[model samples]
Target chain A: MLRLILKDILIQKKTLLTAFIYGFFAIYVFGVKYYTNGGFVAGAVAIGYLFITYAVSYDDKNNCHIALNSLPVKRIEVVLAKYLSVVLFGCIGIFTMIIDGFLAELFGFAMPKNYVAINNVLMVFGVLLVMYSIYYPLYFRFGAVKMNIVNVFLFMTIIVLPKALGEFILNHENNPLIKEVLNFIRNSPKSVIQILSFAAVALISLISIGTSTRIYKSKDF
Target chain B: MSNILEIRNLRKQYDKFSLKDISFSLERGYIMGFIGPNGAGKSTTIKLIMNLIKRDSGEIKVFGLDNIKNEKEIKEKIGFVYDENYFYEHLSILEMKRIIAPFYKHWDDGTFKKYIKDFNLPPSRKIKDLSKGMKMKFSLALALSHRAELIIMDEPTSGLDPVFRIEMLEILQSLIQDERVSVFFSTHITTDLEKIADYITFINDGSIVFSRPKDDILESFALIKGGKELLDKDTRKEFLAIKENSFGFEALTDNTDRIKKIFKNEVIIERPTLEDIMVYTVRGEIKCLDSY
Candidate 1:
């Protein structure tokens, strides 16, 4: 499983370098200038997504699945390796964000507000888990080529979802159910929310991995 | 476990094509030439043996263990070469090797290095930089480096030039000299098998035409040339397929002794090559209808 994940990362070494420079640029111009912590969240998500998707496209481009399956590795290992790769890239994304933060400070640029806050980290991890949880089963079923349109739709949903939710809350501010839900959230403990959020992400990821393994095991090369 | 690879009544169904219940086996320390025309279920069978595709119904055993139940263990000892280059094109050969080498339990870096040098493959060069022949050599080098007991090659010589094909054949020949490794080589190119294959398994239209020792196959099948008048409906049944022209009739038959007994030297019986057997049998039923 480690080798498989390493293979994905090694093949994208050039892309990773370019992404580092690009991440710094984004955090500098768009990150610091725009919505403060949102910039970091957006940058990390974009880089993580780009890395995993590019690795998948590389496999599709070269039909490496056939080669990989012919080796001693199990089908479940391949599926797990892909899920693990998202985590690896997410860590790399966060690590790069720290380096970018330092680089910005060295150049005398103001750092984004609350860039490394625990909430931001949790949000980034949650968003990645949700995105991959939805994306991977479909990928394992339809493959990279057939999932192009679906991928765009999924990415668009991720970009538009927060704004849509905010608008819904504003539009329904007078509604009793909405007010009650907002009050409950306002009264809930921070640790409880964190535990619930972590549980939800873990549950979604487990289901996704199960679905992907089932789809991949019965697949023909 | 004399048989290193075995498939019994294996089947796979696609939209337009299906591999009907096909069965064949290869013993240890011998090369079995899997010869068939295009779309003849050659690759499908190999894929089934490798468990790359799920078999509809049947049993496939490799190294005397169930293929699916023991897939990872079975694959640890099986090296495969497909017709196309499936390695990451952007990565160098060394990088590709690094990724694949850890999967096999018996992966030998020294053996891999020796092949890289012998095949003249630049370790640092990207896979896409290699030519077709070079890419195939790179694939063979990888397949061979792990001390695989059964080497399954699916049309490894299809697009290669004659010289390189011969070179590949020589490598297979030399590998079997130790009498511990067996090769199951699939190709429509029958001549390569003629030189190195110990047994031949022929499939056509998703069905097995024959699978037997190469010499037995050659000895059993005969190409007979005779006047068209001799090919009546009764005598034609003896031939698997027949071709008739204005001058004479040339037919392929497995029953050479029966033909000799019936024709009484009136027909010319000659030894048939593997190509003759494959072509005649594949195109058999459709060729000689008008001659009747």
Candidate 2:
């Protein structure tokens, strides 16, 4: 399973190069203007999931899933390798950004003013886990062609959902439940939310892994 | 002979094409040629045997164990080559092999190096840089290096010119000389199999037309050519397929003695090639009243 994960990363190393480009671009942007810790981290983190999506495209192009399955590995292992690889890429992405930040400072570029917050990093990771949890099952089921269409819809939804929810919460400002929810958000410790969010993402990711393995097992080459 | 692979009542259904109940067994020390025309469920059956595709209903046993239940063990002992190459095109041959080698407990570095030398495959060449035939050699090198007991190939020689095709067939023939290995290969190119296969399992549409020894098929199956007057509704029933025209009519039959007895000296009864069986089985029946 570890080997399979490594294979996915190694095969898609060419695409992973773009994440460096994105990091350099982020460094350039931070140098010129206002860059918060959150903003710098977000720029770095966005490209982490691209590793996974790109690997899917690589597998689709080369028909590697069939080749991999033909070997002495379980279908579930291949599915799990995909889920685990996102975390690996996530670590690599964040580490690259840290290195890039130090280099930018050394080269006489302005650095983000704020320190990296543990709570914010956890939140970002939580969101990534949730997105990947949902994304994989869809990719496993419909594959790259149909999933490409779904990705656009998903991107639109991601952009629109927060605004729609914000409007709903404001519109219901007078409601006792809405006020209680706002109170919880205001009063709860950030760590508590982060831990709870991580738990939820873990649960969702487990469910998605199960779903993907089932879909992949029955998939025809 | 101990059976290395056995499949029974295998079936997979798609909206357009389906594999009917397919049953064939390969002995431990010989090759089985899986022959069918395009869209004849040959590759589908191979995929089912590999468990790369799920079968709707059937049983496949490799080395006397249930294929799905013991997939890892079965696959560890089996080497597979596909019609198309499936590798990280950017990875050098050594890197690609490094990724695959850890999976098989029996993988031999020495055997791999020997094959690389024998096939003249450069260790540093990326897979995409190689020609199709060279890519196939690379795949075969990987397949053979693990000391696998069974080699299952899907159209392993489809695109190769005659030279490479013969070379590949000869390589496969040499593998079986150890008497511990078996080969099951599917192809539309019948000549490759004609030169190497011990048994032939012919598929048409979605079902097995015949699964017998190659010599039996070569000897018994025949083509009958006769005047157009000799071919009619009653006579046509004797042959599996018939192509009729004004100049003459040719038909294919598996029962040569029966066909010869029925037709006597009135028609020409000749040996049928594997290609003839495939063509006639796929085409089944054709009509040509005019000689254009």
Candidate 3:
């Protein structure tokens, strides 16, 4: 399983440099001008997303699944490796953000303050895990070429859904249900919310791994 | 245990094609040439053996264990080469090897280096930059680097020049001489098989036409030439397929001795090549209809 994850990294080693460049640019733009908290989180999430997509695209472009399946590794191992790679890429993304911050400070460029908080890192991981939980099973079933349109649609939805939901909440601030939900979130213990969020994301990731494995097991190459 | 690979009543179905209970076995230390025309389920059957695809029914056994139950164990002992280069194209040969070597239990770096030197493959070159023949050699080098007991190749020589094709056959010929490694080679190139294959398993339109010793098949199947009148409805039963022209008729018969007895000295009986058997068998019905 480690070998599989390492394989993904090795294949995308060239892209790692581009990820660093993109990370610095995102930090400077989003950190200095726009949303302050979102800069590092957005940079890390984008880097992680880029790594996973590049790894999967290379495999699909080369039809390497046949070679992978022909090896002594189990299909479940392959699926688990992909899931684990999200964590690896997440780490790389975090490291990229920190390095970008250091370079920004060294070069005397303006950047956001306290961008790498524990909450922000946790949020980055949570968002990535949930997004990939939705992407992988579809990728395992339909493959990269067939899933291209679905991927674009999914990216669009992700971009649009948050703003749309925020607008809906703002417009309904006077509603009793909205006020009750807001009160519950405000009154909830921080640790409890953290535990519950972890549990929910972990559950989604586990289910995604299971679905992807089942789909990949019977797949014809 | 004597058979290195075995498929019994194996079946798969697609919208346009299906394999109908195909069965074949390759004993240890022998190269079984799997021959068929294009889209004859040769690659599909190979994929089924490798468990690359799911089979609807029947069992596949490798090294005397159920393929699915022992896939990991079985794959460890099996090395495979496909018609196309499936390795990551952007990665260097050395980098790809780094990824694949850990997957095999008995991967020998020395053996891989030997193949690299012998095949003249530059390890630093990216896979996409290599020519088609070079890519195949790299695949073979990888397949052979591990201490694999069974090597399954699906059309490993399909698109190569004749020189490279012969070289590929020569490599297989030498690999099996150790008497421990067995090879299952699938190809539409019958001539290559005739030169190196010990056993021949022929598949046509997802069905096994025959699986037997190469010499036994060659000796038994005959090509007969005679007058068109000699090919009556009753006499036609002896031939698997027949073709007629202005000179007269030419037919293929598996029962060569019986054909000799029936035709006596009136017809000339000639030995049939593997290509003759495949071409005649696959085109037989259509050719018969065309002649009528």
Candidate 4:
């Protein structure tokens, strides 16, 4: 199974190269403009998510599921192998970004505080966990073709809702105490809160994996 | 008696077409040709037996074990080749072997090496760089090198040229010498099956139209060509299909011996080829005539 997973990754070497190039350009632009450690972490997390999404979508498009099913391996092993590949790539992307971040800092670029950097890393991972939690099951049920459209809609909702709510909360002029509390929450200890958020995200990811696996076992493929 | 594979009442339904109750068994050391037209549920039945697709209702036994319950064990001994090449296009054949070698317990590097030499495959070239015949030969080499007991192929020879097709059939013929290896290959090329298969299973409209020994089918069915006067309504019922022109008529019949006795000197009896039987069976045009 490990060998199969590695072969799949190797097969998509061109896609990986494209992803890496895009990541480099995107991160370099962010580093030049924003020049914050938090931005690096955010960039790394985004790239990781993009990698997972591309890998899953490619496999779905090529009917790799059918090919894999024809092999001697069990269905469960196939699923687990996919998840492991995502994790493996995620770690590699994160590590590469960390090095890139440090190099920028060494070259006299402005950087965020260490606490902010740490918090950004945690938040990025949190977002990825949430995104994968929702998307994996959707992909499993509806397939990549349909899920791509659904994903666009879901992404729009996620981005739009938070801004709308934030504006709504801020416009309430009569609630001075609520404003103060919200401000404090926003400015709280970056590391501790980030850790808590990541823990929650990890827990949610586990639940999603369990749910996806159950659905997959019952699936006709 | 230790049949390599057995399928009982296998059924799967789709919106377009459904596989009716289909059943067949392949004994050890024999090649079974699964002959069918396009959309005849040949591939679907293979998928169900391999557990790539789930059956709506049926029992599949491979190597004397339940296919689904003991799929891993069953798969371990079976090697499969799809109609098209499914390997990663960017990887070289050698890279693919490295990746797949660990999956099978009996993978023999020496045997794999021998196949590479026999097939004359360039290990360093990526799969996409190879021709269709080369790609298929590579797939065959992989399927055979793992000490597999059963090889299941879906139209493995459909796209190859005549030379490669014959070569592939020859390799399969040699593989069955041990009496432990069995092959179930589906193909539209009846001539290839005629040359290699010991048993033949004909599928039409998602149903098994005929399944019997190749020799038996050849011996039992025949073609009769005679003059237009032979085309009486009564005799037409006995033929599977018939073509009539101004001068004469040629009919295909399953009961060759009986028909020979009935038409003694009026018609000429000749051996019917597998292709003739397939065409006649599919068109339902067999007819009999009284004129010579």
Candidate 5:
């Protein structure tokens, strides 16, 4: 099963290279701009989330499921391998962003300190967990083709809703509950929030993995 | 004798077609030709046996083990080749073998190397770069290398040229020398099966039309040709399909002895070929009126 997973990764080496190069540069540019514009933490997390999502999309685009099934491995192994690969890629993406943040800091850019950078990593993990929760079931149920369409629709919603709501709440500045929660989160220690965020992401990832495994085991192909 | 594979009353229903109580058994070391037309439930039945699809109701036992309950153990001993190439486009033949070799406990590297050399497949060549025939040969080589007891192939010879088809059939014939291996090969090309199949199972309209030994199917069934005068209402009833013209009539029947006796003096009784049997049986015509 490890060999199978490695084979899948090796087969897409070219795509991986392209995603890595493009993601590194894109995140670097976003990081630099956000640091200059006073939103470095949010910007890094958002760009990291996008990069990981795109990386996961490569497997869906390639119909790796059918290729994996054709081998002698069990269906459960295939599902678990995919989830593990996603998590592996997520860690790599997060590590890349950390390196990007250090590079930006070295370049005399004004940005959040080390703890905020760590919090940004935690936020990226949370976003990836949410993305997996939404996409994994879609993939197992409808396959890659239909999931692509669904992913696009879901991506739009994820991007637009948070920004729209954030704008509305900030513009009104009159919703006491929203203000209180935001104030609480802002005042919470960075370490505590990071731990809670990582815990939430880990819980979601496990649930998604279980859901995908069950759906995949029952799949016809 | 232990049966290598046994399926009883297997049924699967789709929106357009359904396999109605299909059942057959293949003993160890015997080649079973699963002959069927398009949409005839041949692949469906094979999928059910492989546990690739869920069966509506039936028992599938492979190597004395229940198919669903022992799917992984059964799959370890079985090698399957789909109609289309299953390897990833980017994967070279060697890379594919490298990935697959670990899954089977009995994978023989020497045998795999031998097959690659025998098939003349370039180990470094990507699967997408190979021709259709080369791809099929690669798949066959992979299947044989795993020391599989039962190799299930779906239309493995459909698109190959006559030479390659013959070569492929010969290779399959040689693989069963151990007398411990069996093959269930599905193909519409009857000639492939005619040359090698120990037992033949004919499926039509999503059902098993006939299943028997190759010799029995050929010997018991025949094509009777004669003028319309030979084809009285009584003799015509025995034929599965009949074609009549102004000068003569040709009919197909399952019971060659009975039909020959009925029209012994008038009609000519000739041995039926597998192709003829398939065509006439599928057309669902038994009597011909002498009009044209």
Candidate 6:
């Protein structure tokens, strides 16, 4: 299983160089423009998550699933390895951003402070776990080809939803249901909000892992 | 338990085709050639045995254990080679082997190194750089180094040159000396099987036509060639298929004894090769008009 995860990383080693360059640029821009975006490391997390797509694309590029199924590993174990690889890529992303930030600071470029940097990495890591919990199952269920189509819709929604939601919130302040939900999130104690977010994401991720494993078990090569 | 692989009523259903009560067994230490034309369910049957695809009905046992229930254990002891390359195209041969080497407990690094040297495969060259035959050599090296008890190859020789095919067959033939390893090789090319396969399992239209020792199949089936006048209903019943042209007609028959009784000293009765049997079964001969 460790070898499987390592294989995913090894194949994408060259991409790590590009990721580092991108991380450095993002961190530099975020530091100069926002100064503090509360866990600006999320920026790097987004870049790192893209590599997971590269890993899966590798699998699809040659129909590796057939070769993988031929191995002695169980189908569930194969799913578990994929989930673990996603986390591994997340770590690689975080590491890349931090290393680039340090290098930039030494060269006298502005960068996020260490404490904020750590906080941002952890925050993005959590976000990744939640997002992948949804994404991995889709990859297993639809496979690489169909998932690319799904990815287009998903990315489009991500690009469009924020502005749309902001407008909806502003226009619907008079609506009782919208007002109540907004009040709950805005007025909740920090600890209560944290606990709710953690619990919801954790629950979803667990379900995602379970679903992915089930889908892979009977998947035809 | 004497057999390394067994399938009993193993069936899979697709919208257009379904395997019907397929059954065959390959004893330990012999190669069984799985012969069929395109879409004859040869690869489908192999896929079911590997549990790559689920079977709609029937049972498959590998090394005396249920193929699905003992999938990991069975796969540990089995090495599979697909028709085309399945490993990552960008990674070098060594990197690909690294990914597979750890899964099998009995994997031998020394043996693998030996094969890489013997096959002259550069460890650093990416899989995409290698020729089709070279890729197959890499596959075989991986399959062999793991102490596999059975090697299941699906059309491994289909696209390779004859020279490499013969070399590959030599490697398979060498493995048979172990007396514990078996090979289940499927191919449309019967000549490849004729050279090395001890047993032959013929499948057509998603069903088993016959499974017997290679020698027995040759002995049982014969080709009869004579004029079109020998086309009575009783005489035609003995033929699996009959082909006719300007030079009289030729027919295939498994009932060599029965046909001999009817066409004795009149028609040429000659031994049929695996190709002849395969072609006769797949391409039924052109029928003669019912001219009594």
Best DockQ among the predictions, by candidate number: 3
List the global CA lDDT of all models: 0.89, 0.83, 0.90, 0.79, 0.75, 0.85
What is the Å distance of residue A152 in model 6 from its true position?
Answer: 5.0
Q: Evaluated with lDDT, which candidate comes out highest?
A: 3
Model 4 docking tier (incorrect/acceptable/medium/high)? acceptable
Question: Which sequence of candidate numbers ranks them by DockQ, best first?
Answer: 3, 1, 6, 2, 4, 5
Root-mean-square deviation of every model: 1.9, 3.4, 2.0, 4.2, 3.8, 3.0
Over A123-204, each residue of candidate 2 has an lDDT whose tens digit, in order, gives 4566567777878898988887678867656644653576699999999998999999889888999778767777888899
Candidate 2 deviant stretches above 4 angstroms: A15-17, A27-32, A108-114, A149-175, A189-191, B225-250, B259-269, B285-292
Candidate 4 chain B weakest ten by summed lDDT: B283-292
**lDDT by residue for model 3 (B248-277), tens:** 999999888898899899999999899999
Superposition error at A86 for model 6 (Å): 1.9
The superposed Cα distance between candidate 1 and the true structure at residue B263, in angstroms, equals 1.5
Predict model 2's lDDT versus the native: 0.83
* All candidates in order of TM-score, best leading: 1, 3, 6, 2, 5, 4
Q: List the DockQ of the predictions in order.
A: 0.86, 0.68, 0.89, 0.47, 0.40, 0.78
- How much DockQ does model 3 earn? 0.89
**Model 2 chain A worst lDDT window (10 residues):** A30-39
Q: Residue B248 error for model 1, in Å?
A: 1.3
Worst 10 residues of 2 chain B by lDDT: B283-292
Candidate 6 regions off by >4 Å? A113-119, A152-189, B285-292
Ranked by lDDT, the better of candidates 2 and 4 is 2
Per-model TM-score versus the true fold: 0.96, 0.89, 0.95, 0.87, 0.87, 0.93
Among these predictions, the greatest TM-score belongs to 1
Q: Model 3: runs farther than 4 Å from truth? A: A156-164, B285-292
Clashing pairs in 6: none
